[model samples]
Target: MPDVLSTWIAQLAAQLGVDPTHVDRTLLLDVARDAAHGVARPAAPLTTFLVGYAAGLRGGGVDAVSSAAAVAQRLAAEQPPKTDDGPSAG
Candidate 1:
């Protein structure tokens, strides 16, 4: 799975004209996992996208990516778990 994931990331990066070295797959995966488990399953992809966007805005690179992902992971970890009951009307 690691080999396949690495290859896929490389191929996708190449196709997208991005540097494969800029992608820290494990870090990104961890961030996604944290977001999914901490917040909600649907938030995983969106969180990653926002992380990348934030990183890009701050001079994109490994450091930027790491910083953004770290912030996202922290926020995800701090989120309160959702309850099954709907919110009460005001």
Candidate 2:
């Protein structure tokens, strides 16, 4: 990871009153990517938000985050591609 990313995570964690060590950036990034591609671009942030909420309910530990992320990723993987309704009006 770049120093800027490390610095940013540390700063964000501090502001959120979370432990940086338990953040697992790589896993979270993977989950975000899965959500964006498998679901929709907008679903990425929503999925991650839900994962974090679930983890917080589970005590906000590393294991909790990992488990929630895994579930979200699995759901993303199983999601079918979105169907097109039709051409949009300008």
Candidate 3:
């Protein structure tokens, strides 16, 4: 099973049209903020995911998942590289 963070990263990557492996800690936190404000709670992305998950379970729709994933992806893709001349740290 995919870990929650990994899963969220993957989902976010897909949404943002970016690579999952390229998403770093800073970008993750930024996206989490978006989820916090855009979803329900302002602290936990998982809480938002749970809300989405529950809605999906009830309606048999995956829109919420896709939306969350997309948000993650967008956040990752839009991030500026840490260094102007090279890639970021691992």
lDDT of 3 by residue, 1-90 (tens): 987878988998699675565444454465566555443344346744554455456552345445555556565455445454344454
Candidate 2: tens digits of C-alpha lDDT, residues 11-50: 9999999889888889988999998888778888999899
Task: Tell me the lDDT of model 1 at 65.
Answer: 95
lDDT of 1: 0.88
lDDT of each: 0.88, 0.87, 0.55
- Model 1: per-residue Cα lDDT over 14-85, one tens digit each: 998899987988899999999888887888999999999999999999999999999999998888765554
Q: What C-alpha lDDT, on a 0 to 100 scale, does residue 24 get in candidate 3?
A: 49
- Flag regions of model 2 displaced more than 4 Å: 82-90
- After superposition on all C-alphas, the RMSD of every candidate to the true structure, in Å, is 3.1, 4.3, 13.2
Better of 2 and 3 by TM-score: 2
Q: Kindly report which residue pairs in candidate 2 clash with one another.
A: none
